[model samples]
Target: MSSTATPTVEIDPQTVVRKVTRNVIPFVFVLYIVNYIDRANIGYASLQMNKELGLTSQAFGLAAGLFFIGYFLFEVPSNIALAKFGARRWIARILLTWGALATAMGFVHNDFQLITVH
Candidate 1:
C-alpha cells in the first residue's frame, strides 16, 4: 500500500502582485489623493475666508502653518503606535482627530479663537 498526503494548492507571486495592482492600488491612490485634497482645500478656501473673517494674512498664514506643526508633532509617534497596534484602529483615530480639527477650523470666529482652539 502507498500512502501519500494530498498536495496543497500553490499561488504564484506574479499572480498575487497582479491581483493587488488591479484590486488595491487604485483604491489606495484615490484615497491618498482625496485625503490631500481635503486637507489642502482649507488653504484654497482660506484665500477668500481670510477676507470675510477679518483675519490678517499673517493670521491665516499662522493657522495654515499650524496644521503642519500638528502633523509633525503627531506623525512619527502616530505611525509608530500604528505599527505597534494596527492600521485600522490607528488610522481611524488619526482620521477622526484630523476631521474634528478640520471641522473646528470652519467654526472659528476669529484668529484668537483659531489659535487657541488649534
Candidate 2:
C-alpha cells in the first residue's frame, strides 16, 4: 500500500488580527456609519418636511410607515446581494440608489408622490 501525505497550511494569529484590523474593521465601520446616516436622514428631513409640505398627521404617518415598507422589502435582497458581490461595490450601489431616491423625495409635490416614491 502506498501512503500519501496531505499538505498543511499554517497561518499566524497576529497576521490574521492585523489583516482584520487593517482591512475589515475600517470597512465595517464605514459601512455602519453610512447605514446609520441613510436611515436617520429621513427622520431629520421629516421634521422640516411636515412643515414645508403642509402634510397632515396621516400623511406624515404614511410617509414614515412607507419608508419602513420599502426598507423591509429591499433590505434582505440587498444585503444578500451585497454578501454575494462584496461590500465595496454593493454598498456603493446601495448608497447611490438610495441617495437618488432621497434627493427625488425632496421634490415630491403631493402625498401621492410620497407614497409612490417611498
Candidate 3:
C-alpha cells in the first residue's frame, strides 16, 4: 500500500475576517433593525390598541411589563438553537414561527388576549 501526503494551506486572517464580517454583520444589522422596529411599533400599536380594546391603563401597563418577561424566556432558548443549528436555518425557523404568530394576531379580542399573544 502507498501512503499519500496531505498538504496544509494557510489562509490569511484578514480575508477570513472580511469573509466572516460580510456574512455575519448584515444578519446582525437586520436583527437590530427588526428589534428596534418592533419596539417602536409595539409602543405605537399599544396606544391605539388600548383605546380600541377598552384596556384600562393599568392593564396596558401590565401587558407592556410582561413583554420583557416573554423576551427573556425566549432569548436563551433561541440563542441555543441558533448556536446548535446555524444562523441561516435558525433565522428561517424564527421567521416561520413569527409568520404563524402574525396570523394569530387577528384572533385576539381583549387585554388578556392581547397580553397573552404579545
Candidate 4:
C-alpha cells in the first residue's frame, strides 16, 4: 500500500485584517452616509408634506418618532437576520424594501397614511 499525504496552507491574520478593512470599510462608510441622508430627507420634506397632508405638528412628531421606534424594535432582529442571511443578500433586501417604502411615502395623503408608511 502507498501512503497518502495532504498539504496544508497557513494564512496571515494581519494580512486578512488589512484586506478586509481596506475592501469593506469604505463601502460601509458610504452606505452609512447614504442611509443618514435618506433618514434626514424626511425632515426636509416635512416643510411641504405637513401642509399638504394636513398633519398637526404633534401628529407629525409622532409619525417621525415612530420611525425611530420601529428602528429600535427591529434592530436586533435585523442584525440577527443579517448574520443568518449573509451581508450581500441581507443588505440588498434592506435597500429594496426601504426604497419601496420611501417611494410609497410620496403617495401618502394624510397623517394616517404617513404614519402607516413610516
Candidate 5:
C-alpha cells in the first residue's frame, strides 16, 4: 500500500527576515516621516502665530517647548495605566484627553491661553 502526504516547504530564515523587513520597514519609515512633517509644520505655524498673537520669541518658544513636558508627564502614567486597563480603554482615555485639549485649543488667543488650555 502506498500513502500520499502533502509536501511541506521550508522557507529560508534569511528570506523570511528580508520579507518581513521589506514589509514592516516601509510602514515604520512612513510613520517616522509623517511625524517629522507634523513637527516641522507646527514650527512653521509658530512663526505666523507669534506675530499674530503678539507673543515674544522667548514666550512662544517656552510655550512650544512645554508641549514636550505635557507628553513626558503623561507618557509614563499612560503606559502604566494601559498595562492595567488594556489597549482599548486606555486608548479611549487618551483620545478623550486629546479631544478635550483640541476643543480648548480652539479658544486660545494668546500665549497664556495656549499654555493654560492643557
Candidate 6:
C-alpha cells in the first residue's frame, strides 16, 4: 500500500479580514454617498423641474411614488441577480445602467419622460 501526504496551507484570518475591509469599505462608502446624493437631488431638482416641466404637485408626487415602487419591485430581483452573477460584475452593470438612465433623466422635457426615466 502506498501512502500519500496532503500539504496544509496557513492563512491569517485577521490579516485577510483587515485587508479586505480596508480595500472594500472606502469604495462602498463612496458608492453609498453617491447613491444618497442621487436620491436627494430629485428634491432639489423639483424646485426648478416643476416649473420647467409644468408638472403639478400631484403629478410630481405620483412620479416620486412610482420611483419608490419601482425600487421595491426590483430590489429582490436585483439581489437575486447579484447572487447569480456575483457582486463585481453585477455592481458594474448596475452602476453603468444607473449612470446611463440618470444622464437620460437630464434630457427629459415632460412628465411622462421624467416619470419613465426616474
Q: Rate the local accuracy (lDDT) of all candidates.
A: 0.75, 0.77, 0.77, 0.85, 0.72, 0.85
Best-first order by TM-score: 6, 4, 3, 2, 1, 5
Highest-TM-score candidate: 6
CA deviation > 4 Å runs, candidate 2: 1-4
- The segments of candidate 4 whose C-alpha lies over 4 angstroms from its true place after superposition are 1-9, 13-30
Candidate 5 C-alpha lDDT tens digits along 1-118 = 9999999999899999998787656655654655465456547767777788888988877877887887788889889998999765666665566556656655678989977763
User: Scored by Cα lDDT, where does model 1 land?
Assistant: 0.75
* Candidate number with the higher TM-score (5 or 6): 6
Note each model's CA RMSD in angstroms: 5.1, 2.9, 3.6, 3.7, 7.8, 2.7
Better of 3 and 6 by lDDT: 6
- Ranking the candidates on lDDT from highest down gives 4, 6, 2, 3, 1, 5
TM-score of 2: 0.68
Worst 10 residues of 2 by lDDT: 94-103
In candidate 5, which residue ranges exceed 4 Å CA deviation? 1-41
Best by lDDT: 4
Least well predicted 10-residue stretch by lDDT in candidate 3: 97-106
**lDDT for model 6, on a 0 to 1 scale?**
0.85
* Residue range 1-113, candidate 1, lDDT tens digits: 99999999999999999988986676556557657865787668777878888999899779778867976998789889989987656666666665676677778788888
Estimate TM-scores for all models: 0.65, 0.68, 0.72, 0.76, 0.59, 0.81
The TM-score, computed over Cα atoms with residue i paired to residue i, of candidate 3 is 0.72
Worst 10 residues of 1 by lDDT: 26-35
Which wins on TM-score, candidate 1 or candidate 4? 4
Cα deviation of 38, candidate 3, in Å: 1.2
Greater-lDDT candidate between 1 and 6: 6
- What TM-score does prediction 6 earn? 0.81
